[model samples]
Target chain A: MAATIEDLAQAVFDGDSRKAKKLSQKLLDAGEAPLDIINQGLMGGMSEVGVQFKAGTMFVPDVMAAAEAMSAGVELVKPLIAHEDIQSLGTVYMCTVKADLHDIGKNLVIMMLEGAGFNVINGGVDVAPEKIVEDVKELHPDIIGMSALLTTTMLHMKDTIELLKEEGLRDQVKVIIGGAPVSQDFADEIAADGYSPDAVSAADLAKSLVGAA
Target chain B: MYRTRSLYTTAGFQVQQHLFWQMLTDDQCEAIVSTAEELLERTGVEVLSEAAVKVFEEAGCLVDGSRVRIPSTKIQWALRNAPSRVTLCDRKGNRAMMLENNEAHWGAGYTPTEYYDQEKEEKRPFTLADVEEFGKLAQMLPNIDFATQGGFPTDVDEAMAEVYAFKTLVKTTTKPIVQHVRGLAQAQPIYDMAVAVKGCAKELAFDPFVALHVSIEEPLQLSADALEVITFAAEKRLPVIVSNELVSGFTAPAESAGVMIVALANSFAALVLSQLVSEGTPFITGGFFTNNDTVNELHPVGSPEVSLLGGGFANILRYLRIPSYGFGGATDSKISDAQLGLESALSTLCAGVAGTNVIAGAGVFESGLASNPNLLVLVDEMACETERIMRGVEMDEDRLARGVIEYVQPAGNYLATKHTRYYFRSEQFWPTLMNRKRIDDWAAEGSLTLGQRTMNKTKSLLVAYSPKALKDDVVAELDKIAG
Candidate 1:
């Protein structure tokens, strides 16, 4: 029998990791494409969790467990998918800025980006401007994601962007900034390409900026 | 037993001894202060209301358009009469003071919208039931002295959810409740319920036990609805925590001290307005400041500038002789992992040392975007540890010498001595979940991270906790109000 989207989605939501993985593998083996399993089964399940989360019908641990189950299934099918056919929207570099070693926001953006089909390079906390520039030069990523949890270190982003401009690399990269203190007005003031209030919006913006939406 | 001495000065001021001393020599701090003062004088604070502007002008502050230059003398005068200590009264009659000295009380606060998703985890919106669960959990924790109704519950109507959460909070725990007065229509019902539970008609209004937070986005820009809430709350004699959230480099100034002074001026203006509206209305002055560090230029929480801003605000509050509210236990870390521990510990320690009262920002993750029951347990542990630190080491020669001499001269071990048994428990707050077990014991149980242990503890609480039942009449009234 062909598995329905609801059945696959429910398996992920129920936190049945073994079943979620097995189902995804079986579906792939039976001729269902990997992207279909991801969009219909995994992302669909996460969307329900988000609503429950927003509605208070679910709690954090429940959502966390479900996400883990979904991730397990996704990992199982990832290797079977071809690169060009993977339907990834674009590449983005994300980091928590220097002297401010907080990564929760960056990590969320990463997860959201992955869900939206963007390849993410997570530069861990207290990332120096030089390192970001170096990554930009080497990877030539479409977007640079910078984060800071401290007001003192937030100024570093401005400096980083200025350095990129001085190196004549500003036009090559679209810069997106976020954290507790960031705002759209600030983004404009800092000459950043975009600003997002939260991770979901960040993903949406990433897709839009890359002309993938 | 070791006694924790009060670091607060004789005048009931909890001075930031370290930060203040640092400020004396730090040119950066001095420059920021001067620049901030200039901003205040040149730009002036925008008074949200014409009446508030009139009040300041009449009070001798220089008013030029929307910006009002509040001279340092005026600022100092306004602070002089601000009450240093106020008691927070609970429905059951138990109360805690928003102490004047550096004796801070730590508790969990409202969750931000995006907390759990960043950790690759999911935290759903809070509900009345979840609030009730949180209240029970908070009461069981020795460190959390008070609790607020967690942020917007998605399951129920927003207003109804808030009311139910408050009602459940009051019923479940004896800890003083920090409340918010909804729009004018809902205020009376909230007051009535508070009165029914607390035993005073004006108890919710005048009692220090029920402090209300009034949000001011910018200097002088109080929303009309917020003003109405404050006016109503003040008439009842309740203390108000007049606070502003400044997004430094965006809302105020890029310089840390510059941002602080601007926030301080606005906070002072709000408190003065509150006092003017009704005399003898106790107030706490504080603000939230964050560093704007992002490549996209979106503000994120848990920046060092934010911590410093918090610390600076705590000091100013102490200097102004008002109880201070500062953010603590919040980190930019998405998970209840190693990063959470470090960020929470540092931020809390800073607040504690600065002697903040009404310390908030606990049980939140992902830069205040989400709330976690398990994280609350860990945050409580961090608060307890900070309290222990603020208590400081007993300085008397007898206790210090007793152990050393006894071990050197006497043949007996201090571990078995009378002093050790009496003092050890008081000196250390043994964490309920943080593992301190031997390798063999830890191995036997399968070594668990602090997060796992807290999760287990939370599960046990949820299973065992029977929330305090509200009286039938009260329940009926609450349901009707919620409906």
Candidate 2:
């Protein structure tokens, strides 16, 4: 007669977004603790998704679907918890660097980070160094992430970091970079705080950077 | 992978039916043909050559100034008249290659103006000797089945370049040659030269050793040079390849299907003209589908779009029962490196699996401006690998080898079995350029990279190999023609 939190977990695992959101609202309104509904219901299903993904039983689109469903349920549960009580991995400001219009990889990284409980501000594509610096100053993110698919535009990642230094904001923010042409050596040469080869690893590196892993 | 059952017969050869792939279904292919026919009827192609425009006008096509808008019935008639299979012969005039369905054949590549000179370690203009060397390389490479103009020799006059290249290629290689000449001036002499080698015009025409390639300018402009070449090819009963590079973001529509519509219309127009000139003339059709990259603003032959466009074109051409031409083993990298290997491998593999006939570009690279014999050797190895992949596994009872498996059950090895001995060569891909040795053993043998090994092999072949020389009379005849 009553829909339990186990049904909510099953909804998230099955990627049923509407059912998961409805069940989440139903449970929270029924006086279930907000964090309990998250850790045991939403994250409970997402953790199984992560395990199956690493076990090769699931694929990228599958993980993305599960992530979307979890996010849908989380959207209903969040804001009910106190501001400081909710644990976020970190805040990341992300954009594709100047003169490059590619954003497929950047969008995937954002989805992955958001799925992993990180607060991400999407800066979109073709962002110049000056504009990126202004966004960083205003957003006050814990980490800044940059993406570029072209070799010419990847150099702008360095320029953005240099401009951040010139603006005296480099010391306060950790910078990470990813793209087809951006390598780990390139990250080190440009003094990037981190380099993730793919969207899945970007989440792990973000969690570790914020000391949340 | 070998089968004995025959599905169709043409040109005295029985073609086996294999499970070849197509990028489009039957309905999609028919839709493309319909759209292309409509394009021809509505917005016609510009026939800059007055002679070609007159032919189109006399055939009841709408002629507005230089533009010729053709009817769908004329195109359908041309499709029926054009031979589905165009058989090519070797230097001796024995049928060798049957270009039907997805019978893929590898050849030496797109004409290059410059070449990598290993001795000087620099890229420079090609000499006449370089053209001869390319012919020799094509003849020597086991997997390379035919020859195309590999380089434009700068030492020769621009007017005489095609003639001289043909003379060298005819003398050095026994394989079928494809000529993309400037006009009838070069094409005529080359045909006469082939007649001289083959002994008579009638015999040469019947079992043609060469095919004429005509380039239709992008956005549908057929120049006098292209028309003259195609006309000559049709009258002589020689096969002709009507092709163009429909580069997306430049000469063609951005979407693949939109580009396909243009490609089909352009080549179909040429086919119509050829059929009108002489019914039952053999025609091969395709578009070198590629993209003009945003970074370089050049149609990079190695890009993935080349494979995509080539595969789709091949599928549609096969649906129409026409042979197709495509590209493979070309690269965008300026030098031989990991990028070169990756691009060449993927493109060649795609061409192989898609069942494209006459896949060219063995050595040409740097967006098709340079040729490297050493790189060609590396590509030849990749071609071998691709061929092995094309020879898919046999699933019949003998190949199932249940008996051998049961005998060698539970962590047993089949290395010394008779089944392994009998099937290893056909099943495994043997590479010539790839080094597969232990690190210490490799270092002991001088730590040769693939490039170094390719150079050694190329130089050794050039030094030790030469095609059997032409008869003294034929040589004098060729000299007179070249003069």
Candidate 3:
């Protein structure tokens, strides 16, 4: 029997990445659309994972295994996703603000956002506010994610936001801020669209603000 | 209802204690030791060093390539030669800690990538100066018995980090040090620096002020680096803890008995190697066990199973009567929070109750990736609490308080009695971070939580403390060696 999308989802939920990869590759070989495979097979398993994680039925390693399975299938199908496809992902631009050499958190957010199927463009660490505004202009990203580990460097996030407003791109792009010292109040004070404490929440926040969620 | 056990302190003062904590039965311990010995005999450990392999082969262990299958008699021979206790001295030539029966000493982290900056309140890559300040803080803390560099300095040349770290510790703290030398090439410079600080090599070796920490990779593989350091430390007569990374559900089996087998085999291999190098070398053996589960918002370092393994492993060590080490008071949280408090307190208690000698890794958080002075103070307080618990309820007549009870009848006030005044200070656990004030009093003091209080305490300790500087000539010598 040809494995259906439900069978692919079950393989993903079981964290059997080999099965998930093979099944997903088979589905694509059988003339299934990449979008349909991802949405029904990969995301379907992920949604169940979200429920299980929330209900305490799944652990972090379990969740990670499932994510790996989904990522395995997504990696196979995402490249086949055409540029003109109506389901194409919105772009997310990430950077660690000025004077902050720390980028572990920022890099994690980039990796996770990419895993969530966003086209993440990292601007690298210690980026000045002007460079951030320039990247936003050049990229025309749907979302801007800025991070700063130090309180001294966190002011650069506010500067980047103010630059966006000055350049009249504030309404064009939604801004999200995150890091260890960054707080929701700081985000509100800086007039950002949202603040996320970590990578997972940052991905969700970016999705909802871009209307992807 | 508790039976009393009479014990004597190191100072020979008699005390009464009542508590019997056990994580494994006698039969279970015997099974573990014998099985681990059998596992070694059946499946040999991979010895990376060719010279060490020759030494092992000479001792009649069956060698196939790098794999050396150790005989049980070899382990028994190693155990006979190794000391049951190790005495460590401070940099000032003061005897600091005795890693032996009925005692556990606390200390800070040795190797971490990042450090929590107090002024910035954020973690960043550690610099040479950060270690000096952190070492100073550890020296200042009343409960921290030994000091470590706390973080690897990124600013220095990679090869000189260990030497420079030892230099910083020599300058900042008079406490005993635990140094992590990554390779044998980096080992001699640290030893030379310590010798310079303590006058001569023989003097330093006689009453060692520092201990070497070397790691054995799990799945029963001893790396060349660990082998060289153990051999060097054995020849130098310095204490060395040849530890293994026993991450449950990853490295060793999650089952208790199986965990013991691998943990013991790896440690015993190191012990045999150390004895093989130099008989009567002060050697300590233990593994860093983390129960790799994040259930209930706990880090692996803070997980209850690490403590469970610690308690069980401590008993196993006692059963073998080997002076041992155990890890405690670590967390995965980036900042001090409820989770941090829970993790630190539980793991620290397990180490103390299990009577682990040299409870290591006090200041570490973020699963040992980062060190924070605030967490160090928090763990110091936890160590104090562990001391109180280990004191147990004294079962003497005076402690039974018959005279006090007769002096003050029911419904009478003991607060005004001499007994209350005499014993209250020692009997009650006085918390430094915990607030037990009236609600208004707490709010009046800015409504501080325990984390905030811990931070405040850390800052004040740093402010009020000034470690005695080394002599100018000694400083110059250390700097020359460091360079």
Per-candidate TM vs. native?
Answer: 0.61, 0.66, 0.66
Error of 1 at A64 (Å): 48
Model 1 Cα lDDT, one tens digit per residue, B361-380:
77767766677667777778
TM-scores of chain A across the candidates, in order, are: 0.85, 0.85, 0.79
Candidate achieving the largest lDDT: 2
Q: How many steric overlaps does candidate 1 have?
A: 40
lDDT of 1 by residue, A10-103 (tens): 9877756777888887788778878889988887886677677656565444555566678788888888778777876779999999998777
At residue B31, candidate 3 shows an lDDT of 90
Ranking by lDDT: 2, 3, 1
Model 1, residue B463: C-alpha shift (Å): 3.0
lDDT by residue for model 2 (B192-233), tens: 999999889898988898988767657777778888888888
After TM-score superposition, the amount by which residue B237's alpha carbon in candidate 2 deviates from its true location, in angstroms, is 0.6
* RMSD values, in order shown: 23.4, 21.0, 28.1
